[model samples]
Target: MSRKRVAEPGPLSEHVPGRKKACWGILTSQGSWADRSPLHEAASQGRLLALRTLLAQGYHTNIVTIDHVSPLHEACLSGHVACVRALINAGANVNAATIDGATPLYNCCASGSAACMELLLQNGAHTHTTHAHFPSALHEACKRGYSQCVESLLSHGADPDYGVAHLGSALYMSCLHRHTECSRILLHSGAKVNVGRDSDSPLHAAVRQDSADQASVLLDYGADVYLRDSNNQRAVELAPPGGKTHQLLLTFEVAPRTLCQLCRLHIRTVIGPSRLKQLPVLPLPSLLTHYLEYT
Candidate 1:
């Protein structure tokens, strides 16, 4: 997507008058020039001053390009918090989606911007909005190892188990990418450790990454060690021979859990996924709370 600054000082000029028409260009697969807009340019470049000036001049905040991408989408995708705030305050639709169905919140996740994500959520961005053939915001955050973005989305009521079409859940994406912190935060947020059918489980994805740390986090959060994949192979069987992941899985298979670990798992199950966050302040000892939280 290319943004051509208007040469004359119109109500939506991005530069000083007569400043040589510098254009900020973004390479894209879509060759159609009809998708470009001045609002998009201002937001994509984090031009807060120009954006506000345009809004003050009565430019529509909800204007979209040919593909239906709004200025709010551009601002959030670029991680421009000030521009995002300005657009939202000017009545931009926080949940505006592109023609491909990518929402502004999804763009924020792709950018890994917790501030932009938070601002969009505060302005009523829908957490359940999913892109066509793409995952939810939480899934995008996990795939990119954006732990803060994951936390922000989760805190604002994003569903941890919201799976992508044919791509499994956020936990699976985190495990697939070997993002230990992202996996940990998802587990803490009560994501299913063994979600998906057969080979699509988070454990299976973790084994595919050959990451002992990521596998351990899943196992610690109560992932089933003996679950079979589509090929009837267990996660341990999928691990590379003599690898750290294989060694770690082998040990886990043989070692019995401590009484504390069993109690934590049981408590988590009883509390249900959404209520798991309340355990930290449920009159329990701080150490026990930390242990339950896997801190």
Candidate 2:
């Protein structure tokens, strides 16, 4: 007896011609159709078989969507491990970026998907490349408080000092976002505690946030306690008045502003005519008050 050959089912007879067809799990025209391939959609839906078939059919592995997003980026963003694996196996560019330069790891980090991030890492997704919006995977993980993701990134040798948009590095983002644990990890992993931006230190950003704990953490990590900003205001000036941040600054022995001292001396010079004639006088509060009344 001859072996029988089984025929695969053809395209669904009810499928409308020239209308959108579901190929490899993506709703699009036929592979030979004139329009673009739906790689992003298939990758996004975790349609592993369709993705493999598309690749086998010589469809461009890096076909992008209307937004210029790649299939690998879609897989990472959607947390589709299988799709990601298939795309990687099919020679999809692991580090292929969208128009804005966001890699697969950036997408995984944005989603806080550690599994996806790990897969991307194992597959050589570039962790150092930043998008126009954000820099490294560590920055996104820190911003989102994803400690596991952060740790995975660190373990993979992702630098915690990666900076973006001239705002400074991953440690800078961690401090600005007040992710204490993540910041601590970054600090221990060689992130610069005093990574300065526009003359402000991590301590200054922490002070601006009014988080005494974060300030103390940065300080303990060697952040410059006396760093000032563009307005000539130091960390102490940024702290909320009468809060624990205020009480805590005294422990650091930071001197208050001398503007009040200069104001007192100038007032004494203007009002105390007799004292000015006698000699220079220290502008004690009592002497200043006496001059106010005498003048």
The candidate maximizing lDDT is 1
Q: Which stretches of candidate 1 lie over 4 Å from their true place?
A: 1-34, 130-135
lDDT of 2 by residue, 10-41 (tens): 57767566656554433455433222356666
What's model 2's overall lDDT? 0.69
Give candidate 2 regions above 4 Å deviation: 1-37, 49-58, 130-134, 254-295
Candidate 2 clashing pairs, residues 3+ apart or interchain: none
Error of 2 at 170 (Å): 1.5
Best by TM-score: 1
Model 2 worst lDDT window (10 residues): 1-10
lDDT values for all models: 0.81, 0.69
Query: In every candidate, how many clashes are there?
Result: 0, 0
RMSD of 2: 18.3
Instruction: Name the lDDT value of residue 39 in candidate 2.
Output: 69
